[model samples]
Target: MKFKHYNQQQTVLLPYSFDDLIPEQHPVRVVDYVVESINIQPLLKAYSKEGNPGYHPKMLLKVMLYAYMTNVYSSRKIELALRENINFMWLTSMTIVDHNTINRFRSNKLKDSFKEIFKQVVLMLASEGLITLKQIYTDGTKIEAQAGRYTFVWGKSIKTNKAKMLTQLEDLWNYAQSIDNDDNPDPEPTQFKEINKEVIEQTVAKIDAKLSGNEKASSKSKAKLRYIKNNFVANLEKYEQQEAILAERNSYSKTDTEATFMRMKEDHMRNGQLKPAYNTQISTENQIIVHYTIHQNPTDTKTLKPHLENFEKTFGKETLQQLKEITADAGYGSEENYDYLQEKELTAYVKYNTFDKEQDKNYQKKNKPFSKENLYYNQEEDYYVCPMGQKMHKTHQSKRTTEAGHTQSLSHYQAKNCESCPLRGQCFKAKGNRSIERNHNLERHKQRTRELLLSETGIQKRKQRTADVEPVFAQLKHNNGFRRFSLKGLEKVELEFGLMALGHNLRKKIAA
Candidate 1:
């Protein structure tokens, strides 16, 4: 078959401008709207100088925020996009900016400046009646930090590892010397033999220098160096294994000692490697994150009160007063948390056990004749009534004040009461009598539990907590590929967490 083509010249023209592609009322427009609405002019006046040649703070802010909203985290990517992508061009008004400028704006200028801006957006939404602000959910999810688990070399572990290395090095050296003197020694020994000889020699020298018994350097300093070297060697091996596994798995895994392992709840056990991570807490109202922070703590229990206080600070006390309820999962539940919510006059729906039904059933079956709920309390007498209907006398009442000045009233019951009860075998497995201790704030806990069970609004609000917060974490870990952090130290990790929360909020805004 033969095909003939006629030579023809055709010119095609594209008419749409970058601005035309972006809607006038897009969330990116809200960036300008918020700046104008809050009158950032005063802040601009305070920082701007007539002779200075700096990018307008507002312009830089808009570009950075727009980039964050779209998940373009790297400043280099944002800089390249500004000259190439239409949407970014529209956001930056077609300005030719460099990566350094964008990076400095995000890392230095906006870190402090944008905090106030985030707060203002919360207030604006509250004022417009878009946010109820009557209730909030507090929760934390682990995000990988830039630091690695190996970065933290425990002093004890370091000493142990160094001793082990020295022992191995000595043995290898002795073995090499033995092999060299053997009758069957090859003119050229295997590479393993040569490598082991070199390693043993080098390691012995390093160990001797480190343990030179020098008086100039403190023992602590010497120990620290030894520990650091041990950690470096271990980390190098770890990285090699991690690289092999990642290559086999065909995925990117961070190698920095400071890099932490963070995965979404669903992907947590994906690779069977538990990594050091940071817990990021977000306080949300009406589906928007009002306050956020990053903690070095691995568990959710310790993060509750801090984030609540942060939320109050971000929205002000008056605004926080309107928040009547706080919701969280069982991970945040504890006697201390119960007291904290009670002291703040805030109702909470934090479940003590996420799988209570199954757990209760298993516990009941495991210990027959007496279940946990069978233990009865006699409120009037300030004592417990045994299953056999015996009245247990109060052994003692102790009072103590916490550092926060909250008074605790504790009462312990007599052991003799269980000794005489017919159901004593079922109630007390111990040889001595059973004792019951009750907190003064027990009533507050009872009230809160009742409210959580009975209030429709409370139940509905609590149901939304997991849906709202978990999805944010899922997107961060799975979609955006933020399984671990790229920075080190608590403060830097916190800054990255704030940026992530900001990214999530921006996505919510854009989707809305």
Candidate 2:
């Protein structure tokens, strides 16, 4: 057979819209369909009545979301795709959108509506039966922020520095008064609160005028005055802000002050150097991120309550009240969490401190009766019998308080005759006697937790929670290369995570 000849410069007239350029079954079609279905009123609310015409929110949201789905997070890259990529051109209708506009829409216009929009998508998934909505699995990972690794500030460090600076301020105040021959008592602590950047500047100016005119002030006094003026007074606002963050947070980043300095596992040097990051918590079902929130807390313990609470609130009480079970790792094991789930009457497979050790027989045997698991307690008499046949009598009841001032009941128990017991070497480490403090309510709740954790259905759910949630994070970070956040501050950080989750969900929807 003869081959067809091709012309070097052949041009044919063909009529086809951008829609025809992208197939009907393409992923862009799914994005377009979903974008068309959702209510864009929230996005439109950001625009004024009329000035110059701008890109529609639906087109912008579609492009932004599609960009995230394809792992193109940068605005400039998205802008280039909008112009160069035919699929993006088809989805965005070939509209030219600048990178600044794209960034603004993501970091500004879409910030407030991130949760609402994400909730809509999740609710849609729930309605479509993609997510069960009956069970929720929450896990947190530290995502580095768009701040320098060295720009870290701990709240404790600020308080220590502040105290030293305050003492120096007092010393300088005394020296200044002595130099002026005014022997009035230095300003009180209450008066110190009134001293601001302006006050310090005025005081420094007065001292400088006196020193220049008379030159009798000591070099030490002049240096101290200059030091406080240059450093303390200049950065008073920043110091106050840092102290405020430190008062509430353990550690904060200097560049992005709201970002807490957390040790991320993806350290290149393997030394666990602190990076400014946000602790991002996400609840997943069927490998789709259903809900997510940013927390400053470095650990996952405190995030559970608020995460679940926000989950319920986002979907509404009636919609989420049916959710009766939650599964999480041992990182979220705490009495406060267990009690909260109990109070809400929701089933929780939340582990406690010793939950993992209790699972292993060898570990259990190593710390039996002393482990609280091996202690045999009499329900009627309310006393525990040690493995050595010694009765641990309840000595007293006391209230133990947490940092948040929340109180819990603790029963102090003393093992009778531990001083002369044969197993004292193995059991009792204390000199005189062995004492145990138990939170009676917490222990009872833990017993119930342990039973559920060991049950057939519970075991399956536990496995499913790990299987469902972990890969979502792994894919988000490793596959998509989303190890670090491209934004700064909590709000912007939240918005970026929201978009990523939404994109990931949309991709899942497409695959389905």
Candidate 3:
């Protein structure tokens, strides 16, 4: 094992410099081209004039887009990279911007601007034959919000807790005073060492003021105060327990009051806990995201029309008209939604509950055909025919008022007729007559459904919706680490969601 040692003198030389390492037309370089193509100078000019002195909006946007593309969401980390990482250096034009500035830009003016920029990119891709505007898939996925579910305090609960806290304080003060009197041998000494009456009175007055304000506070405002208090308490507890957990090998758990629990699927207690999030909706055509929105609404049914309307505004009238089919899962299914699609003359494959296997399986086997779709309607008779070929005559037509104070003309069918019919067991179990209530828009819904079922391409496109949309959410949660939002309120949550969608679209584009 004899070896010869010599003074280090040998050196290796590289053929190319760091600048030459990256291709001149790399996707990173295309950042500038994309920005220029979108024509964001006016936005930059506006922001610059409004107290943002030297920083260019394009530079900030490019940095953000690059961050999203790479899945580096934290503003501080992005700021650190600019001063260190070569790729970020080049992307941000070698300018080092602070994390606060980066964050402010993303959270403030950049949200709307990025939304418009996303649309422009989608349009650009469409023009380049990279995307087709004909068929689109729409879906929503819940991302955890910045606030915890526990932080959502009901007004009733807050009132109860405030009263309890006040009582506790009063009892503690009384006990402390009793202890002082018991220990005091002289009355003069006890009087001098008494608790500050002014402080107690002020605290009581403050509590009373809070209670009075609660009566005037909106439900939303009350929730916000509770959220802040919960966060404050949780943070305090976290710090107090930090030291005790430091030495233990298995007990280093911390609670984030501002973190809400959400999930991709409704599985109670899994691998790692997820937090409160928004339901992000995205509309895609030919695998490119054309329209996107983020909502605090936990459900998907309410988001369909708004997102579609936003899509129309983003792409212009001609491009919107080119959208032949809108596909969504059972979550987007509603009679109103179907009517809306029909009014727009847009084919929709919005699956109603009957289409979902879990829901269908829960129904009695014989009753499955009793679904609205399976009930044969005779256009000539203006009535429904049972599966057993028994006609359900319109017994009565009367105007009915809804809880919302809207009147509708409802035609009721004979329940007695259904009782003796062979399809009675399948159709209705009610003691009274089984009725079919038709809305004024019933025809519109039927037309929409007819169009959707008849179009071969539309049907095929609808089948592809789950494949196209669900995977986006899967990647966002499992791969991209975007299970919950880092911000609060619906608006900020929405902005965060837009960023996530932008990230997804950019990744898809790059991969394609």
Candidate 4:
């Protein structure tokens, strides 16, 4: 056997660049290419001309995105990569950026401008014929926030505590009135609107003044009054502030005030515990994330409008004009969403909650023979034929207002008689005749969706949807291990995810 001549101290005559050391088809090259192609004036504007020039935002962006693509999310690890990894060195041209600088650039500098950067990348991808922007497959997933799971503030808890305080205040006020001999009595039932520190202080002072030196008032009650005077005001103010932060959300994480507690599917314990997470909604075209939005609400139905609105705001309404259709799972199938899709003049291949069950013949025939779905409706007469062949006439109409403020008109249909009926035991669970509510407009929309979804084109789109969009999440979360956010606040987390989304697009491009 022969061994090749190798020397530890051998010096080369030629000096080659870091580019020569990297492979031509490396993903790092693609990252550099796509990032360099985008207009980074938004990122450049973050810097001031007065001070000494910092590490180029362009370089930092490339490095951060590449790091995320490779599953190195920590800033310190990225800094280490810049020093140790050959590909990273080549990408940054041997410029080693410190972790603090990297974190600052990501957390502060990229916060406002990341959306533009992401849009530019998507546009670049569009130019390359990767994404059509014709039809978008939308889906939402809950990603855990970079906060302690137990550190949560529930709006319900706040309201309950506040209610207790109100009760205590009322008792104290009534006691004060009963004991006081003054002719000028305090107003009965003080109306507390938007409880604040000032309101509590004023109420406590009045009660304390009336109760002071009164023999009828017990010492324990006096101590409680003092306690209320000392703590109730501060506690009420805190609850008020928390409710303000909560807005429409039921709960928020104390560590990350913007992060709402949501039930995530990635439950390691299998107990279905609610964790502090953000509802991440993304619209994809040809497996590339064209647009994304972070929402505090956990429900996907409420997020569609804002997500599409942001998509238009980022890319322009002209971009939405280019969209021919939008497809999503049952989570996004709401009357509000359907109406929005209709208003946008875009075709919806969305599925409602009962779509799958409606497809099952056994469900219709055996499982729910007496259910509203199995009943036959007469469009002309506005009545439904029940399982017992009874005529369920349209009795009245009602309207339901959704969280998004969209009013849904529904017609109530009730069976004329269920008493002494043979199927009464099976059908009539309530005290009176069996009734059902139907949203005509929503039913029409569902019928249209059913037609579209059952069509040949709809079948292809439906099949392609899971294959196209799901792998993006599977790759990012399961394969690449980006299940949780690294940043605390919403804006910073959005920037972080934007970087990851850009990385995903670039990686997909490289794979192609």
For lDDT, the strongest prediction is: 4
Choose the strongest candidate by TM-score: 4
**Model 3 steric clash total:** 11
Which ranges of candidate 4 are over 4 A from the true structure? 1-6, 177-199, 367-369, 386-392, 415-423, 431-434
The order by descending TM-score is: 4, 2, 1, 3
- Model 2's TM-score against the true structure: 0.87
**Candidate 4 — which pairs collide?**
none
Estimate the TM-score for candidate 3: 0.68
Candidate 3 global lDDT = 0.63
Global lDDT scores for all candidate models = 0.63, 0.81, 0.63, 0.88
Per-residue lDDT of candidate 2, residues 1-512 (tens digit): 89898896776697568876677788778778887878777777888887998778888899988888889999999999988999998877668899999998898888877688888888788889898788888889999988878977877776677667666765665565656644564343334445466656666665565555445688877777778767986567777877777766788777888888888899978997888889999989899998898998887888888988888778888767788788888888777888888888789887777888777889866866666656888878978888787788899999888754458989988876776788878776768767788887887888898899899988998889889999999999999999988888889988998999999999999888
Give the CA lDDT, 0 to 100, for residue 312 in model 4: 86
How many residue pairs clash in each candidate at the backbone level? 9, 0, 11, 0
Q: What's model 2's overall lDDT?
A: 0.81
Per-residue lDDT over 1-512 for candidate 1, one digit per residue giving the tens place of the 0 to 100 score: 87886556644497557667888877777766665577455336436466768877777777766776667777789889889987777766788799998766666665555566777766776776656788777777777655544444333443454456555555443434443434663322222232233454465454445345644445654554555446646644554455554332222324443333444444445765556566688877656776788764455776787877877776688877888877788787666778888778887777765334534676656645454344567667666666666666788889876543446788777555455667776666777777766674754575566567447875676668867666766777678877766556555566666666666666665566
Model 1, residue 283: displacement in angstroms? 2.1
lDDT of 4: 0.88
Extract clashing residue pairs from model 2: none
